[model samples]
Target chain A: MAMSDLYREHILDHYENPRHHGTLADADFSHEESNPLCGDHVRIDVKLSEDKTRIADAAFSGEGCIISQAATSMLLESVMGWRIDDVEQLDPQHVLSLIGVPLTANRVKCALLGLKVLKTGIKLWKLQQMQHSA
Target chain B: MHTQREFFDVHAVRRDFPILQQRVNGKPLVFLDSAASSQKPLPVLEAMERVYREAYANVHRGVYALSEAATAAYDEARAKIARFIGAPAVENIVFTRNATEALNLLAYAYARAFLREGDEILLTELEHHANFVPWMVLARERNVTLKFIPLTPEGLLDLDAFERLLTERTRIVTFAHVSNVLGTITDPAPIIARAHAAGAIVIVDGSQSVPHMPVNVQAMDCDFLVFSGHKMLGPTGIGVLYGKRALLEAMPPFLTGGDMISYVGFDDVRWNDVPLKFEAGTPAFVEAIGLGAAVDYLSALGMDAVRAHEAQLTAYALERLSEVSGVRIYGPQDPQRRGGVIAFTVNRIHPHDLASLLDQHGIAIRAGHHCAQPLHQRLGVNATARASFYIYTEPSEIDALAEGIEHAKRALRIS
Candidate 1:
């Protein structure tokens, strides 16, 4: 594939001007993950609605390749107002589609790093809640 | 003074490497990733093929002619490697899978056998993971302390800091001869001398230096030296760990099963001699033979000429790469103090992105930490793209790399 295809205009735009590219001070849950191979890092913070059933807002911060940083920006933008349940159900294919390009095996990790951080944080937060209620 | 151009013709030498003739992405291949692994020359490849075709058999076993031939070739390879590195004897060279495995062997057999709690292992920030991780594991297991010799702002190891770090508790001093990322060449002679005075055994990771320059283990007086075959125009699956005679004899075997044992009884077994004591199972005899041929090729070219050629290329590369805007080259600016490897970052472009863009032009480089994360952490950068040179590398490839960086900058809309 051409280099341009991988770094498309939208991808470059998201990289240059990332959306939701900061942390929320009162985030309900936050988690960070890194690709050890390339040292690409992504930390995701989520704020739930008052009822605590929907993602009212989300933000991501990290340093990495264009695909990683851009994909994280796009991911955070799309998951705004998403139900907590639906966000939990978010799969890798959805993230790949969001990327809108075929990624090599190495790059798939970069493109999906945000989703991993988001899902892992929610899962850990849910476990904490269960422990507290019990 | 003889010039490299007068003595060594890079174009003629390039013909020895078959892979260099290929076209990738519709452009001539500009392989600048020799620091990762070098391309095999024809002599090395032919030697390996000839061995498999003519004398294919398990070594040190059968009494048949084929086995004997295989054993002879393998033994000769060890001798050639021993001579290549100025080792005292052939018994000092132990074959392992690669440089990583060789380091692990030393960690398990030497450090685990000798070190005690609170014993210090002085390493540098410039080590590759192969040199770093094994010792780190040993520190965890043996309750040892790992101290690092810091790097100067220019990326050279601070010898004064090294002197201060060496204490009575320092049991081992291990470091890379050349930094894979920064291209800094640490002179082993003084370090070895000081480490010896401090009662620390020195292990030199010569993976990057051995291929690009002349390295004499005996002259350096390092306790152990480790290097891989693939990085020196040889086949993979072969590496060498050259240790002092007494040390190799003192250390226990790291891996044990076959060949390494002198005899096996129902309840007891006796270990073999020093070199074979370390080499277990069916070894990579063919690869070793190929490595022998690689040594022959390099010797024929003369290592002095090889070093001169790379020095010239490194100087030219540093000059050309500096001309490009937003390019920040790492390591010593002077090529005399470093290897042929050049690691740099361009503007705000991520190394992976830069590598991908360069790949489109058929220019291969290493991106990311290059397995030197601690050094990168010290540099305060996540990653840098690296371009390394070899005997066959040309000045035009460096020109291509400089041009390719411009193309990458333009594509990413970086002004």
Candidate 2:
């Protein structure tokens, strides 16, 4: 318990010195995802590519416990260059495995915060596409 | 622990709650959320067990041996609750599913009997939804106004706001004896006095107080008081609502069925006595007995000791959590006037993360809106982490919580 495999130094480094923690409100699409249970909220913006094949640029703004904010920050970094298919197929295990196994049953939601926001953004993008087609 | 300190011994009291023996993740159960619902002691469980084993029959309807025994036990349980809360008589004690249901009963009976257009129901900003929603729905139905007593800067009830809100139009003054979130104990005497002077009936939601502190319906002099058995270490689906005799007699029954009517023939009926007039169906006999046992058990220890123990534990928890940098505690920061409930949010870390980290160490706490959505909104947070304590809680558990929180901070990489 003393040496947590779940909370690695890298996670701490990313959490303490967060990258791209602000927002891009001028971006094409912005969505907010919040878990009311634990007071975790993330506002995400995406400037989608004209082709819609890959995410062009992404940035996030949020305040939560470390798991939520860091996971969100890392997730934004992880998905920026990847295609929609790659992002959709991207397993949360990859994110969790990297962080180590310090999570208990209830804490899984915090660790999974990034994945929820990323998925929600993708869903909102698809909805917007349908709206334009109509 | 000064109040009733000589009546009970803490070491002897620890052995009563069986849940303490259980191990989770190879550690003893460090339960810190009794406000949610307390674990049952052996006495309560056995009371229910003994009823099922020896006397298992429906009450008030049957005349056989088992039926008579069951009816007697049920009535005896009501009498016990009446004695426990210092109710004027057993007839004033009406059993409902829980405190929520007891409050609902008031709404149903009052809506039918007293409510009308332009009436107002006065409530506080710091109320659990159970206490909030019933009155809200009632206000909607009666086309009445639901006025809230503004909270003080420190999360206590703004007594001036409460006094100012009262008018001839105010039908009821509803408030919690002790806030479930803040644990701030309100001296309900003056509030009840003001409400009565304004011709407004008073309803005290005693779910939080009856379990931890001594309550006398006569002394409080409120129109009604409601509390749940489960929150006080009894079985669920059982609660007590004590109304003044005149008030109980005047209000219409909330439900209609057999046993509540004294005479029924050809579409004509006469309702039964005071308490039975409200309890319409087959009552929770076993649970009622268990609640009686729970009342006995808590009384044996004494409310004064329980309050003192919780005060010490709450102070310890507040002191420890405050020591951690970047931790923002909620509710009244002063621990002396507060009960054992403490809610906090760690900077750069989510409450879910803190809860999960603590769970691994077998320390249990509550996180989220905690059914007190308004308080969360007032604090300008959507959610927070809460840890509540009871008689069995130990100082070591607080240390464990602190240790677990530190681990969460490091793991999340928050300062």
Highest DockQ, which number? 1
Candidate 2: true contacts recovered, fraction: 0.78
Residues B1-415 of candidate 2: C-alpha lDDT, one tens digit per residue: 1222223565667788777888877777889889999989888989899889999888876789998998888889899899999997899899999999989999889654788899889988888888999888887777989999988878899998887899999989999998888787788899999999999999999999999988898998999999999999999999888999998898888889977889999989999998889888898889999999999998888888888778878877888889888888877877777878888888866676577667767888888878888877888887788899887777778888888888777766555
Which residue pairs show backbone clashes in model 2?
A: A6-A100, A6-A101, A65-B348, A65-B349, A65-B350, A66-B348, A66-B349
TM-score per model over all chains: 0.97, 0.86
- Point out the worst 10-residue segment of candidate 1 chain B by lDDT: B1-10
The segments of candidate 1 whose C-alpha lies over 4 angstroms from its true place after superposition are B1-6
Worst-scoring 10-residue span by lDDT in model 2 chain B: B1-10
Give a tens-digit lDDT track for model 1, residues B304-379: 8988888888888888989999999999998899999999999999998898889889999989999999899899
Query: Which model scores highest in TM-score?
Result: 1
Candidate 1 local lDDT, A1-134, one digit each (tens) = 77799889999999999999999999999999999879999999899999998899988998999999999999888888988888888988888998898887888988999898998888898999999999
